[model samples]
Target chain A: MDIKDIMKPENMVYSKTPVLTSTTMHYCPGCSHGTVHKLIAEVIEEMGIQEKTIGISPVGCAVFAYNYVDIDWQQAAHGRAPALATATKRLHPEKYVFTYQGDGDLASIGTAEIMHACNRGENIVVIFINNGIYGMTGGQMAPTTLIGMKTATSPYGRDPKLHGMPLKITNLIAQLDGTCYVTRQAVHNAAAARKTKRAIRKAFENSALGKGTSFVEVVSTCNSGWKLSPVAANEWMVENMFPEYPMGDLKDR
Target chain B: MAEKILMKGNEAIAHAAIRCGCDGYFGYPITPQSEIMETLMEEQPWETTGMVVLQAESETSSINMLYGGASCGKKVMTSSSSPGLSLMCEGLSYLAGAELPCLVVNVVRGGPGLGTIQPGQGDYFQACKGGGHGDYRMIVLAPASAQEMYDFVDLSFELAFKYRNPAMILSDGVIGQMMEKVELRPMKPRWTNEEIIKSMPWATTGKTPDRKQNVITSLALDAAVHERLNHTLIAKYKQMEDEEVRFESVQCEDAEHVIVAYGCMARICESTIEMARKEGIKLGLLRPITLFPFPKKEINRLVPHLKSMMSVELSTGQMLEDVQLAVNGRIPVNFFGRLGGIVPSPEEVLEAFKNSINK
Candidate 1:
């Protein structure tokens, strides 16, 4: 088949799933948020939970998760998406609720909320995007920034002596008895993307089964913040970020 | 039949919340207001009525948990003291922005930081004005007595659900720690799950393909859209002021001195009014029940007849500003308050009223 024919509307197999819409995403060219969003959308579609899913959008770069995910969406306060998700799930115990948060939101200001929610065994899903630096705020040092990661706020590289160690949310939440599933996955390559999708699905499934809190920490790339081309950013994330963050389940039940 | 039972103000509020069919109770233990959580925890309304009760790790978690429940169209609540309430401000703002119906009880103590765990009305401005951010207001109900504490829980829930806004019962340490005779009402569910879901179509439960997708967001990126949203919120606030403004006037119809007070201070002001009446001084009291709506019309009406108005509070003259605005310089407004847990007595208030009248 010709390339033109493959791109034609008649030849294309369009998904009629309620979870994914045709809306154009606002992500940067090399941003991994789109891929993560798509995977979440696909999972909601596959599970036939489009009409029974509620998503909480965080404050950072992915603050617009509501626009992409064709489900009931609520915009949470900065670093309060976990709390919002906890509220949404408890109120509608029959419905599936999840939150999409970034490193700055989840690991920093929102730490108390997420930790307590997990500790209380709140039946909800939390999708934490850990990109090491603050994306929307112009590459500031995040709580999850690597030891030598240099950003606007940590120009001389993140010093453990000065700024504390990088937070491993998956490991932290895994220790909590309330969390039934905890995983850290990357979305740098196609293989990693598939595993990240699986992690997202498992997180939602765990919540659906009333298995308490399920947390997925996705190691994503911020090309604009990293000051790299789309391809190079993915390569850099795979080489420098993934080994430190790791890609595996910390806890599963 | 208006039967009375002795109860602590916090306990009264807890009983009232359970009676009002509050579906979820999320809170962390805090001084003075801890009884509210203790009552719920011991009562275990969840076992009987399927209420979801969770003792959160912190005030921040509790408020957020309330946020989650509210988003699902559930009648949820959280109670805390001054310092704990401060931590919940961010979540409170989100609840208000999302227009979620929830009850937040702040049994206020003295504060700027962790000031004291004693009774004080320091949070008057925080509760009446926007506590968090954005142009938003909470339906602030000030309960002056144990009876009102019990009654106001239902009122707060009704107002919260009716307005699609967060409602707060602003009590104080005096009320929370003190016990009084309160009439308990039969428990009745105000709304079924179906009714609640039907009432809040905008709530983020889930979306079906057959219906238009609903987004509950505070963000309006465009300047024009943002302004329009703010305008809509302002209109709602105006409507609340018009329709829900509540206050109680005692002997104000034929008095020379009017005392403007609310919450615990208002209760004390009532006694002062009685004492002044016995002493042959023409004195009356104006007790605001809804602090945000503020009973401005009542204050304006009383201003023409008043020789002087003394605003009494448990804090350093916060509500006095509102009283001044209401009087609009038509009458002299004086302020009397005891900050950091020193509640002004009726004698002190009477003395202040006497001084204001002499001036």
Candidate 2:
């Protein structure tokens, strides 16, 4: 058989989801945001809800998530995505609503909004990307920065007494009665990406069932912020990030 | 004629909003204005008219909630007092930059920092001037009576959607808490989902197959694009200035002096004008209904007929600056105000007007 003849539809194993637009992502090389964005687009496409999904983008690296995802989007102020999502979901109950936020956006300035939204049991999905550093405004210490981790702001390495401990926010979210599903996953490899995708799909499904807030915290890698190569970043996340944020479902109701 | 019913100013707003077919209301409780939401909760518009009413966690959340609801091309509104309105300035700027239409009601109370809960017009500058950090403007309506409070809700939303800008009802605690007989309008049906989708093509309802995805954001990274947006906004403001100036001229046909005022002070000036005319003072009142597109033209038109002018406000001469600018040294304009939530009586205003004439 010729090579041209072998390239047939039956030979096709996988393809890109059309839910994502042709806009080139602005994330740094080896960044996990692209992987997470791809997984969300795939999940939206698979569930056939692209026309009815509204995504709220935060003020971090994924602020342009709206550009890549071909869906209705609203960019919220720093730390106010949950409040926006709460209103959007309440007003349009038939539509699927989700918020994509970073560690700094959710854990620092917007703690009150997140805590109240989750407590109110809003029927929305929250996709939290925990990279342990602020990537958009240059590398700075995030609330989730690991102890002894070094960033531009934490040049002396993060000290527990000075910078406080890394916040395991997913664990706290799991305890909220409003949350029906809370999980922590990663995308360092193909297996991990597949697991994260499954978790995302379930979160969307829970939204359809009118279940209270579905939260998925993705333990992500920021190579540029971490000052590491792409391959080394993945290895470093597995060795360091995974130990602090274990890969499993904390609450699945 | 519509039947008249007595109600508080804040309660009249709640009734007017429902009658105007508003889609949602997100607000936090504040002094003298909590009755707006209290009435909505008591009425249960959610069960009857399908209106979504939610008490947000804070004013920050409430204003952002209005941003979200308005982004979907829905009729939404919020109400707050001075301190709460201060907290909402950031969100207000975002709403204006995004060009979203919604209604905001500020029942003014005394304020420098958590000032008295009594009636005061201290927020005149904040409302007509820049309350947020941007070069944007909101259509401000100052209502002196409960009837105007009831009537301005529909007008504000109509103007808001027409211009694609935010609108504010600048009232004081005296107007918000007082009781008066207001003629209520009939209930207008709420817009259906299909109606909203058709009317608001730019709304972020969804990314349907027939149209492009709608993105609501105030962020533009490119300098040229932001500048163009600013130019467009400026043009819209100019249009408002030309077309939306509203004021009431009370007995100004043949007068020697005019009293410039708005909101509750305008009402007080009515009494002052009565007292002054009885004493052969020849004083007439010019009440600005629209504070942003102020009655500057009317003030100038009456300048040749007047020898002097005076500005009466609950604050210490915030609106006086605008009056001075309008007069432009043509007339000797004076300001009379009482601070710290003390409302000047008609006698005090009449005495001040006489003092200006002597000067």
What is the C-alpha DockQ of each candidate? 0.70, 0.84
In model 2, the number of clashes is 0
What shift in Å separates residue A68 of candidate 1 from its native position after superposition? Answer: 0.7
Candidate 1 has a TM-score of: 0.95
**Model 1, span B1-359: residue lDDT tens:** 76788989999988898887988888889898999989888898877777877777788878877777787778899999988988888888877877788999999999889898888899988898887888899899998889899999989988998988899999999988889999988788746766865878776657876577778777788999888878887887999999999999999999898888888888888899999999999999999999988899999888888788888988888999999998988878898989879887899989987876676
Off by over 4 Å in 1: A1-18
In the range B23-73, model 2's lDDT, one tens digit per residue, is: 999999999799999999999999988889999999999998888888889
lDDT of each: 0.86, 0.92
Candidate 2's displacement at residue A205, Å, is: 0.8
Model 2 chain A is weakest, by summed lDDT over 10 consecutive residues, at A107-116
How large is the interface RMSD of each prediction? 1.6, 0.7
Clashing pairs in 1: A87-B68, A87-B69, A88-B68
- TM-score of chain A, every prediction, order shown: 0.93, 0.97
